[model samples]
Target: MSGRCKGGKGLGKGGTKRHHKLLCDNIQGITKPATRRVARQREAHLGAHLRGDAWDVAGLTPSHLELIYEEMHGMLQVFLENVIHDTITYSEHAKGKTVTAMDVVYALKHQRHTLYSSGG
Candidate 1:
């Protein structure tokens, strides 16, 4: 018998190779108009909230509001950073590619900000 295998299951010498496009090319499908629309919507929503009754009740001047906004934003940023860091740590420890609700719950619990039990 010949040295060659009977079946043609072996890898062929010549075939058109599949070329995957770059990730950036795929991301380019989200056109500029769609991005602008989302930005405009967010701007409008934020403007409405800034002009809303909540701020009206506070009766703070623009300067005072700006100061408070900066302080509150800084505190929120720090809090979010801590929570996200903890969440990512939990996810990495569990060898999970995606963070689940349980990971978040556990992270919050670890930080003494427990939301709810894992069980129903």
Candidate 2:
């Protein structure tokens, strides 16, 4: 097996009937770093920084980053969807137009005030 990646090995009916090779190339992918950007890692770093003020982050590990990243991303996705949906509904019915960036900004502002406007 050469270093070049291979796919679909055929071995059936004396090489007459080609059988699809289910396990061809390595399923785990190459050992080297992936060329694509990993968003989860980036998200984790942001979360670590956000909490660094109150917690010691000098000994954080890759696994910890991934766990925090997953939770942050999961919760943010849900929150964003809800925010966008509410803004879209209001903008469409009230203004009779498509949503815009201002809609998002307004939604965010409204949510912030609604949730965090306590005596200040």
Which structure among the candidates has the greatest lDDT? 1
| Candidate 1 residue lDDT tens string, 6-117 | 6644467546777967543233354545544644565676786544453341476778865755554555457667988999999999978799888888888888976755
Error of 2 at 51 (Å): 8.2
Per-model C-alpha RMSD:
12.2, 19.5
Q: Stretches of candidate 2 above 4 Å error?
A: 1-56, 113-120
lDDT of 2 by residue, 1-120 (tens): 575556654556235555768753342342213311334354465686544334333377978855755565555556766897878876886755578666666677767724244322
**Residue 49 accuracy (lDDT) in model 1:** 54
TM-score for each model: 0.50, 0.43
